[model samples]
Target: MVDKPVPDATRRSEKSRRAIHDAALALVAEVGYPKTTVEAIAARAGVGKQTIYRWWPSKADVLLEAFLDLGAQTARELGQEPYVIPDTGDLAVDLKAVLRATVDELLDPRFEAPARALAAEGLVNEPLGREFVAKLLEPQLRLYVDRLRSAQDAGDVRPDVDPRIALELFVSPLAQRWLQHTGPISYEYTDTLVDYALHGLAPR
Candidate 1:
């Protein structure tokens, strides 16, 4: 069967939805999570609050979808596959490539301010924090988990290693630097992280 053409009204709605997502991201970056409301996002987007409500159940819902959209856009711009980590048959190379991309994302101005705001709120608000981690963070982390598991099958990683916990050796460090400003982030830094995580630091 031939695909039905998209209606003009639906196209208009999609455009409005993109506006809402962009407005929500910008507002959250400026105002923090506690103060960024549905009304505020609608106003910033020049859409009616009812328009936002018609599409999303709550402010958090809008924000979540906004972030998901942001990641997809970034992925496309970078020419990388969205929502998947590359294997390349080398675990260390794969890890470093992903980490470098992450460093780029963390440094991106559009993503940085809003992500920092949400992360700060997530720290103080347990439920919100957990929800964000579950939805936004965990899925990304799972890509690493899958990569590590594949490494194990290929004998690149020790069979005894737990993919979930093992992957954290590099990920958490980058997250700490990004979230806490503990240190500067760079391709070299993340590359070092991947090396140390995969190979013991104590002269291994």
Candidate 2:
């Protein structure tokens, strides 16, 4: 079969995939998502228009993968698994530890720029917003679900509580702070979140 014509296109496609992801993230960060386009990404990435279309159906898809890749890279650098929350027996300690690390990740420039861009877009783009929540955000949230379930089983958390919703008490507060400039995030803040969530805000 003439050595399959060297498969040069496959190698070129892989390079173009990386380039497109980089370009999409940069464009979103620089111009915001409303003004970003496949044409702009293609030009910035130094690839043909068809190259991006070949892989991702839309800019939202490209951005979603870019954000996921950034998270994975950061996790690898920190020597932690990207999609699992640790259960160290002490529920408060474990939750606080993970949330503290998340505070660091959210504050990092590399993660912040692109994430803010995408989040701003998602606020107005209904379909894209739901997709981001479903695919990228929800999967990560499920990690907390798993951790909380373990805590419930261990009698650290109330078994009657729904782990999914329970996890959100702490998770959503931190997310809101980071997303909306609502407040400062720190180990102390996250620690407080865990404490309040576990013991209840009332006079427990």
Candidate 3:
């Protein structure tokens, strides 16, 4: 039996999809999400308007895919898996290491611009905000939840604590600092967050 050749149309579609993602990210970074349009992305991507519409329902969809791809690429570059948080028995050490890497990612030029644009838009655009939180943010956050639960089981964390809320004590502060430029991001800062969260600020 002969091997079947890959379909030319499928190959073409994949190329177009990558181009669209690149174009959408570029446009969002350059002009912000509210100003980026399907037509503009198609033009920049060297594809037709119909091609974008055929693949995605809206510009938000295209941007979401682009952001997700960027995150995966960052994960690969960091020698980390995109979907899992490390659980190395010492919860503070593991959390600090991951967060230090995240600080590097947030400061990366390629990731920062589009991410800032999308995040700013998400602040005011309720539907897009919710979509981003649900699809891109929450899934990543669940990894922390899993790690915390394991820590609790190991007696490394307080059993009565809610993992979801407990994770936020460190995670949300870092997120706010990065997102709003409220403070400096450093290895020390993140390490401190881990220490503060785990040991409690009330002298325990």
Candidate 4:
């Protein structure tokens, strides 16, 4: 008898994982976080509920990993490294570049809808909110903090300035605008934010 070809288990697993991530994101975007359950995600992904349970403990874990996968995929598509802040010698230019990328990501419909749903849910569900912050937001914020610290070392920022607080000057405003629909987010707007943040409003 002829030897049979071996099945590519890894490739099959990857396909299923991607499907699960996509399904979780879509479900959360369409139904909001509270209504997006593990069973729903598994059904939407065309995977057995047992498969989802085997991979993740809860719906929140599934959603978190899905967002993470989405971010990494987006970064690859953009030809940028995932979860990194650039460190060019010019602090203002570097900040503007990163923030401009952020603006693009925020405006992307694929990212926007699910992100808004999660943020809204986080507001009411304290435990989920904390998990979101701990798993996602805080790590991203640390990137900014690290970049700011480098700028400080180079004397681009004041030694007295707190990197943690300093980063919020630009990051918080952009987040607020995107989350609250208070204003349009554009590359130009983010560039202005970087400039104003690097150079005080009181003038040189």
Best model number under lDDT: 1
Q: Any runs in candidate 4 off by more than 4 Å, and if so which? A: 1-7
* lDDT by residue (tens digit), candidate 1, 1-204: 998999999999999999999999999999899899999999999999999999899998899999999999999999987677887998888889999999999999999999999999999999988988999999999999999988999999999999999988999999999999999999999999898888887884
Taking all chains together, each candidate's TM-score versus the true structure is 0.96, 0.91, 0.93, 0.94
Runs of candidate 2 exceeding 4 Å displacement: 1-12
Local distance difference test values of all predictions, in order: 0.92, 0.87, 0.89, 0.91
lDDT tens readout by residue for model 4, 1-204: 997865799779889999999999999999999889999998999999999999999999999999989888988999888567888788888888888888889989999999999999999999999999999999989999999999889999999999999999999999999999999889888888888888889869
Expressed as tens digits, the lDDT of each residue in 66-154 for candidate 3 is 88888888888878975677777899888998888888988998888888899999999999999999999898889999999999999
TM-score top scorer: 1
Q: Ten residues in a row with the worst lDDT in model 1?
A: 79-88
Query: Any runs in candidate 1 off by more than 4 Å, and if so which?
Result: 1-5
Report backbone clashes per prediction.
0, 0, 0, 0
lDDT of 2 by residue, 1-204 (tens): 365564888888777877888888888889999888999999999988887887889888888888888788889998887557877788888888889889999999888888899898889888998999999988888888899888888988888999888988999999999999999988889999988998887894
Among residues 3 or more apart in sequence or in different chains, the pairs in candidate 2 whose N, CA or C atoms overlap within 3 Å are none
- In candidate 1 the C-alpha lDDT for residue 54 amounts to 92
